[model samples]
Target chain A: MIDFSNPLHLLAYGVMAAGLAFDLVGCIGLVRLPDVYNRLQAGTKCVTLGTCLLLLGVLLRFGFGSMGWKALLCLWFIAMTSPTAAHAIARAAHRAGYALWKGSVGDRYAEDDEGRNIQPAAAADRPKEA
Target chain B: MTALDVLMLGLALGVFLCLYRALRGPTPADRAVSVDILGVLMVGFCAVMTVATGKDLYMIVGLAWASLAFVGSLALAKFLEGRSFDD
Candidate 1:
C-alpha cells in the first residue's frame, strides 16, 4: 500500500546512503587501526550509525507495517547491545593480561586494574640477580 | 540520480570495506568484530536491495538476518572473553 513515488522514499534513500558512507569509513578505520580498543571504537560507532540509517530507509519504504516496525525494533536492540558487548570484550581482554599496543599513547585502565602489574611470567622465569 | 540506486551503490562500497577489514584484521577479536559488522552491513544491503528491486517480501528475511547478527555478536564476544568473564 505504500507509494513508491512519495517524497518520503527519497528522504529514506538519502539517509540510507549516508549511513553506508559512514559504515565504509568505519571499516577503513578498523583495518588501519593498530589494536583492539581502537578498532572496537570504530566498528561499534560506525555500524550503529550505518544500521540506523538503513533501518530508517526500510521503515519509510514499507510505511506502517510489520516489517517496518520490526526493523525499527531491531535497530533499537542493536544500538543498545553492540556497544555494551564491545565494552565487555575489551574489559575481558584487559583482565586476561593481553597487553595493549606499546604505541598506545594513554591508558586509564592501567591505573584502575592494579592486578595487571604482577609480573607473573617473565619475573617468575628469570634467575635472581643476587 | 534516484535515491535508491545511489544508496545501493554506497552500501555496496561499505560492504566491500567491511569485507576488507574482516580479511585483514590482525587478531581473532578484531576479525570477529569485523565479521559481525559485515553481517550487519549485509542485512542493510538486503533491505536496500529489496526496496530497490521492488521485492517487498524480502524485507522480512532482512529483518531476521539483522536480528541474528546480535546473537552472533554476543556469542563471539563471550568466546573472546573466554573463561574469566564468564566467571
Candidate 2:
C-alpha cells in the first residue's frame, strides 16, 4: 500500500491519475478521428505525453533509487522516439499517395514536389534576380 | 481500491480502444498509427506495474519496449513508402 501521508506518494498519485486520463483520451481520439493523419496527430502527441508522465510518476514515487533512475531513462527514451516515429509515418503515408481528408487545407509536401518538377512556376513565384 | 488499481483498469480500457482502431482502421497507415500508440501505452502500463510490484525490472522492460517500438514503426514507415531499407 502506498503511504498517502507522504507528500511524494500523494504527488505521484496525482500525476499518475492525470497520465491515465490522457492515455484514455488519446486512445478515444485514435478510434474516433476521421482520417489516418488526424488519428496520428492525436495518438502520438497525447500518448507520448501520457506515458512520459506515467514514468515521471514512478520516478516521483521511488525518488532517486534504482527504480526512479530507470523510470527517468525510460521517460527520456519514449520522449525522444515517439515524435520522430510519428513524423516518419506521416511522411510515408503522404509519399505513398494517401489522400488527405476532404476538409484538409493544404499539403506542403505536394506543393514542394510540384515546385520541384515545374521549374517555370517555381521560378515565377521567386523574386527576380537583379 | 487504490488509485493504482483504477489507473491500471483505465489503461486496460485505453488499450482496448487502441486495439479496436488497429483492427478496424480503414487504411494501413491508420493501423500502423494505432500500433505505434499501443506501444506507447504499453510503456505506461509497465510503469504502473513497476509501482504496483515494487520492482525495477518493469522499467527496464519499458525501456527496451520503447526502443523496439521505435524501430518497428520506422520500418513500417519505410515499407509503406515503398523504398529499400537502406534508403
Candidate 3:
C-alpha cells in the first residue's frame, strides 16, 4: 500500500492522476475526432505524454531502484518512438489516399509534392538555354 | 478504492474506448491508429501495475511492449502505403 502521508507518494499519486486524465481525454479524442489524421494527432500526442508522465510517477514512487531506472528507460523509449510512429502513420495515410476532413485548413504535404513534381516538368519544358 | 485502483480502472475504460474505435473505424488507417493508441495505453497500464505490485518485471514488460508496438505501427503504415518492407 502506498503511504499517502509521504510527500513523495502524494506527488506520485498526483502525477499519476494527471496522466490518467490525459489518457482518458486522448481516448475520447480518438473516438470523437472526425478523421484519421485528426485522431492520430490527438491520440498520439496526448497518450504519449500521458504514458510518459505515468512512467515518471512510477520513477518517483520507486526512487532510484531497478523499477525506477526501468521506468525512466520506458519513458525515454516511448517519448522517442511515439512521435516517429505517428509521423509514419500520417505519411502512409496520405500516400494511401486517405482524404482529410472537409474542415481541414491546409495540406502542406500535397503542396510540397506538387512543387516537387511540377518543377522538374517545368524545367524540362523550357527551351535549351546552353 | 485507492487512487491506484481508480487510475487502473480509468485506463481500462480508455482501452475499451480504443477497442470501440478499432472495431468501428471507417478505414484501415483509423483502425491502425486506434491500435497504436491502444498499445500506448497498455504501457501506462503496465506502469501502474509496476507501482501497485511493487514488481520490477512490469517495467520490462512495458518497455518491450512499447518497442514492439512501435514496430507494429510502422509495419502497418508501410503496408497501408502499398510498398514492400524494404522500401
Complex DockQ, candidate 3: 0.89
User: In DockQ terms, which candidate is top?
Assistant: 2
| Worst 10 contiguous positions by lDDT, candidate 3 chain B | B78-87
- Judge candidate 2 at residue A38 and give its lDDT: 91
Best by lDDT: 3
* Model 2 chain A: ten consecutive residues of lowest lDDT: A120-129
Worst 10 residues of 2 chain B by lDDT: B78-87
**Every candidate's lDDT:** 0.70, 0.89, 0.90
Against the native complex, each candidate's DockQ, computed on alpha carbons, is 0.47, 0.91, 0.89
In model 2, which residue pairs have backbone atoms overlapping below 3 Å?
A: none
Candidates 1 and 2, the one with greater DockQ: 2
Q: Across residues B34-78, which tens digit of lDDT does each residue of candidate 3 receive? A: 999999999999999998899999999999999999999999999
Task: Report lDDT (Cα) of residue B44, candidate 2.
Answer: 100
Q: How close is candidate 2 to the true structure, as a TM-score?
A: 0.92
In candidate 3, position A99 carries an lDDT of 75
Local lDDT at A126 for model 3: 31
lDDT of 2 by residue, A85-105 (tens): 999999888877676776776
Q: Give the C-alpha lDDT of model 1.
A: 0.70
